[model samples]
Target: MKASTKNVIKSIAVLSVIALVCVAILSLANVFLKKEVTLDKATVKFLNEKFATTAPTTTGTDSDTAYNEDYFVMLTDGELSNASGYTYKSFKSNSSNYVSAIYYAQKGANEGVYYIESVSVGYQNPISVVVSFVIDNGDFSIQNIAVKEQREDFGDRKTQVLNPETFFYYVSLVKSDEDMNITDADIIAATGATTKKSVAGLNRAVTRAIDTMNKIYTKSDEIKAEINKRGGQNG
Candidate 1:
């Protein structure tokens, strides 16, 4: 073969090898990176364990029926908190869409539970979180709180907001009627996450939800009165 022919063949062979190597590396990285972006089996189980409840069985039934389906009764348009008419907000982020919802149950077996789920902007991406506030069925004093899902990343270091124990410990400091005083220092101490962006974002979002709830509770009398007026009209 001519010298030029041999040179072109060698160049083609080198390019082929480089292409194959690049594809292999990408495939390998995808295996691990994909799991981080989506919800995993553990997170699903945690969400159910925290928010799931059983349905009430009828009389003469030996087995208790689990009311897992249709358990959450969303507040109606007029019943929604003063924040917005809908319980859930489709919040659009810079690159992705995050959701924030507020659900309440008053006349069911799951009464006294106020479900709040939100996604707040974090260090690198949006942190999806779900919190369950237990009430006394008559008042808004949160008896307990539970975090269902929290996904956050910071540079090369990811946060453990999904870790049930640690996440709960940090959330315990937040109260229903009281204002959250979670400072940058507090977040760094508790979560070891980003204090400037991630922590602040989470704090502001969570605090706003809490404040909205407080406003609803404080005006419970008026809201209930309106509900009664509507009920009387329907009847």
Candidate 2:
């Protein structure tokens, strides 16, 4: 073969090898970076079904009514105190006000966890107070808890208190127990004082806040149910 022809063929081979290497690297990077996101729709549906199966039915027996009243009384007494407790001290100092809403999530057969998220419309910030419990034979007991502020941006300033793993860890603490119960002290201990600038706005904000908390609590039930259903099928 001519020397010029040989040189051209060698160059072509080198270029082809480089291209193959680049493609391989990209493929590996994509595989490594791919992450599993929210649960699948079908799995969520299955989980909801399982959760319902395992959940205790609410009855109107006198015992049941009394138990519920006891739980509510405990929560109400707690509310009478500063709704957010010491956690709201910072906001109070700055005259940065807040409004809170209580949210409940089922933890097990007779247990439910509560979360109090306070929103400061003045500063556009939200603080979270978590309380968990279980009700056994009509008694409420504390399980776990955490109080913290969420991330936010105030024009030139930005802040984040906990990462996703840590935040989820706090959430899991409340949701993992099967026999935890609710109590008045637990409710009082979980929150601090709340002040809303506008009464109507405060009412609306509190309602929405409670609803949001409830949504998150229900999601745990959905996940557990789905996992159980999938496990049963495999068995």
Candidate 3:
């Protein structure tokens, strides 16, 4: 081959290698990205499915079918406090992880309830749960709970956190005026959760959900103001 032809061939080979490397990097990035994003996707799907009946309807649809709009609002720390009226006392100022998102059940049996989604580490992986908190006359309490995901296999012990009727045993552990500082020891003492590690995970999650509810209650006035500012009236 001529010198010019050889140079061109070498350049093409280098370009091909660079392209392959770029593709590999992008593919790896996508996998890691999905690992983080999958939790969010699952959270959204869980919220929508749980609150599907009460979702708002899109007027232009051919049929009068109501659409489940993305109801979970992931508020920043400032927005959660300043904008959403979340109180500082309800949650531990030093603690970092808790209540990742809040969902409003707009129109159904759960009409005015707020669902707080929280996560805690289990024996193997993170445990995510959503609890419905009802606000009535400035008092807030956990009305129901749904476990979105739990990585551990707890055998029959999962019933302690999964069933609402039985789960109230855990809710009863929380005090309205105080922060929920439940530990593994507390979880083991309060209920028949087989594995202390699993029980502790669920307890921490439940406590966090209650904390979010209490914060909203403490700042009920601010929350009302926020609602009114957005053209909504506090019920």
Cα deviation of 115, candidate 2, in Å = 3.8
Residue-level lDDT of model 2, residues 1-235, one tens digit each, is: 9999999999999999999999999999989985322223322222223123223321112333423332211122132223333222222323333423333332223335443434433225444333343334544443433343333433444222223333344234334442324222332233221222222222223333333333334344443343344332221
User: Cα deviation of 160 in candidate 3 (Å)?
Assistant: 6.3
Alpha carbon lDDT of each predicted model: 0.50, 0.35, 0.58
Q: Compare the candidates by lDDT and give the number of the best one.
A: 3
Across residues 142-216, which tens digit of lDDT does each residue of candidate 1 receive? Answer: 433454444554255555443455665567656422467666677667665543666665665565556556545
Expressed as tens digits, the lDDT of each residue in 31-112 for candidate 3 is 8875432224455456546433334321222111213332333333454568654533345423334665665644444445
Candidate 2 TM-score, true structure as reference: 0.23
- Lowest lDDT sum, 10 consecutive residues, model 1, at 58-67
Q: Which scores greater on TM-score, model 1 or model 2?
A: 1
Query: What TM-score would you give candidate 3 relative to the actual structure?
Result: 0.56
Best by TM-score: 3
